[model samples]
Target chain A: MARYSILVTSSPFTSNGGANALAYCQQLVRDNHTIDQVFFYQDGVFHANAFMHPPSDEPNSVKQWVAFHEQTNTPLVVCITAAARRGVLSQQEAEELGYNAYNLLPPFSQTGLSDFFTKLHDSDNLVQF
Target chain B: MATITVRMTTPPYQGISAQDGLDFAMAATNYGHEVQILFEGEGVAQLAGQLTPPTGMKSHTKRLKALPFFDIEELYYCTQSAQARLTDGQSLAVAAEPLSADGVKELMNSSDHIVTF
Candidate 1:
């Protein structure tokens, strides 16, 4: 199976990218392909939020993603620039930076948007979902 | 190296852009050419699941899946875009590498032809 790198840069509820990103990952796993990583940038950082609460009746896409990451140990890296632009800060970081607590989680790590470059370079294939 | 990367710049269901993009990718793959799909801006929505297409429209996600049959296995999403704007995780169901600015630039560079829809 060929390995791939999928990038998700849209919000889950706002438009289309959110749902598509999750579906793509699931199919890849089903195909028995290796996913090198999933990088979150621009408005895509919210997927890393641990407290994302959708209605019980509604299918929880974010929760499903969390489970995917947890089960697969997939690395979900959030872009620091976009997160800061959207004012998504941790409790401690928010207090230190004079902001409100917007998100807190462990499956995600914050870094520069440029960090994902190496992943793309080394990837056997790249497809955007 | 006539590798082509199909870049999605529009959101799904907004218009025919996503469908059009998929059609083009499929055509290329059917011709036995290397094809890749990259989502930027709102294009990442193409991978979002649970979408009810407007009226008679078919889901772009379904079309996206068929790409592999044509050997168009390259699919990517902007991780930065997904995290910053994505409201829910269910919408994005693909395995992707979140791309940075540099990654995008490099993708553009590596591709022999970049088609944006």
Candidate 2:
């Protein structure tokens, strides 16, 4: 199985961009490939929110991602800068937002943009959304 | 010794870029080349079981399922994207992962060449 790292830089609901990112990773898993990591940046950071509740008419994107991580045991990393900029704060986000600290959590870890490059260096393939 | 990676950025029922990427990857495998496909951005819809293509367009979701038979084993989707769509692991017909951006970069580094559509 090939190891892959995918980067998503689009909004969760804007233009259905996030949906496309999910397809790439799922197809790899179907082929018995390994997903090394997923980094959510830019507006993509909103994806880490578990509190998101979309209407019945609209599908819940955040929930779908949470389940995907739970099943694959793959790590999801959100950029601190992006999260803060977008106002996506975990419990730590309160402090970060107040003191300007970075707070990202489980299923969604906090990291630097440089980490994205590091992961890319180690992956068999890398794709950006 | 040669590994090819295909990146998808279009959503289902919106455009043919994702389907074209998948089809091209399959064709590469058929041509005796190694291939890997990654769906980023809106391209994740190619795996959405709820997809309903408009008239005249083909079903990309079905075409994507045929990758394994062609030995196009490496398929990847952005984890954040999946979360955005509310698509779970079980929801996908194939075995898949929620790949992180970092992982995707590394995967690209391993490839000899990459293509995005």
Candidate 3:
């Protein structure tokens, strides 16, 4: 099985890209392919926001992504600069930025572009959405 | 080191995709990777020489021109896209090579990884 790294660049609710990416990842795992990392950049960082509260009947992308990470043991990374610029902050970032609240979901770590490049260097395929 | 081709299809300043894509490419080079940038679809508009962005917005043209300094010299644009969008006498700000559809496909096939924005 080939190794894959995913880059999600669109918001979860704004477009189908995020959901499609998640679906793709699930398929990859089911097929026994190794997913090295799922790096969220641009508006894709919204997927890591713990504050996301979708209607019960709607698909909860954030929760789905969190579950995917739990099952597959893949690293869920969000670009720190992009996440901060879009206000999706972790507890440490919130404290540092002097914000009262944090929304970065668990199992998802904030990182730099170099972290992504390192993973990409090791992966056989890099899929973007 | 791997060769990573970053394909950009979004116009500049509409959102942060262009800047983020560039940042990703630049960072890849820092890790000793070779980066090639391809501007296709509306992304070709970003290469127009005389871009005057709205007030307070960062100039993508300026950043794009600085790619060579970062060792990102493999800049390319889709010839058909450029011809359709760029009017006569409109110059490109960067010295990007024009590639045919087949050339683009070959570039993607030859790269170790492909990232799109």
Candidate 4:
């Protein structure tokens, strides 16, 4: 199976880009392709927000992603610069920065955008949705 | 040696996506990849030469001008969308090329990878 790396750059709350990326990722895995990782950049960091509480009946794209990672053991990395600017902090970052709350939870970690370039090289396909 | 295409689908002035797309394309060049920047859809507006942001706002023109210095000269805007701007008397950023629908198709078909913002 070819490896796939998906880059999601829009907030899950603001647009369908995050959901779209997830669906694409699912299709890739369903086709017997392997996912190297999901690199979240720009507003896409919102997908990592642990505190996200979607209203009832709304598709919880964030949890859907978490479940995907849980199923396939694929790694998810959020762009550090973009996540920080938007206040999508990991628990450690929130404690260090003295923020009242933190959102980045399990199944998602942080990395620089440059690190993604290397990951891209290792992947058979890189799709940004 | 990989041919990477970064396609921006939104205008730079509207949000950070366009700027971030440019940044990644530049990063690809830094990594020695053959990077091509393609502006599509509303992204075509990002290549307009008449962009003049109010004082204190980032000047996209300045950032675009720096792309050539990075040896990333393969810049193009969709010809299908060009009519939207040409009909309004707008022109692309200096030296930015036009990519016909077929050319865009060719790039996607040939590139090792495609990333859109």
Question: DockQ numbers for every candidate?
Answer: 0.04, 0.03, 0.81, 0.57
Residue B7 alpha-carbon offset, candidate 3, angstroms = 1.5
Best by lDDT: 3
lDDT of 2 by residue, B14-84 (tens): 64456546655775666556788777877776667756778888877677777789998778888777777
Q: Tell me what TM-score chain B of candidate 3 gets against the true chain B.
A: 0.94
- Candidate 1: which stretches are off by over 4 Å? A100-102, B1-117
- The 10-residue segment with the lowest total lDDT in model 4 chain A: A113-122
Question: What is the per-residue lDDT of model 4 for residues B9-104, given as tens digits with 9 covering 90 to 100?
Answer: 888777677778878888878777788888899888887777787667688878898998887998888988878755665756757678899999
Put the candidates in DockQ order, highest first: 3, 4, 1, 2
DockQ of 2: 0.03
After superposition, the stretches of candidate 2 with alpha carbons farther than 4 Å from their true spots are: A99-105, B1-117
lDDT of 1 at A35: 84
For every model in order, the fraction of real contacts preserved is: 0.00, 0.00, 0.90, 0.57
Candidate closer to the true structure by DockQ (higher is better), 2 or 3: 3
Q: Is the docking of candidate 1 incorrect, acceptable, medium or high quality?
A: incorrect
Q: Model 1, A1-129: lDDT tens per residue?
A: 976666666776787777887778888889988888787765677776666778899767567777888888777777676676676665666788886665846667776534554455455665554
Error of 2 at A10 (Å): 1.2
What's the true lDDT of residue A124 in model 1?
A: 65
In model 3, the Cα lDDT at residue A112 comes to 88
> Model 4, range A31-120, lDDT digits (tens) per residue?
999888899988888888877888878887778988999888889999888998898998888888999888888889988867887777
Work out the TM-score per prediction.
0.52, 0.50, 0.95, 0.88
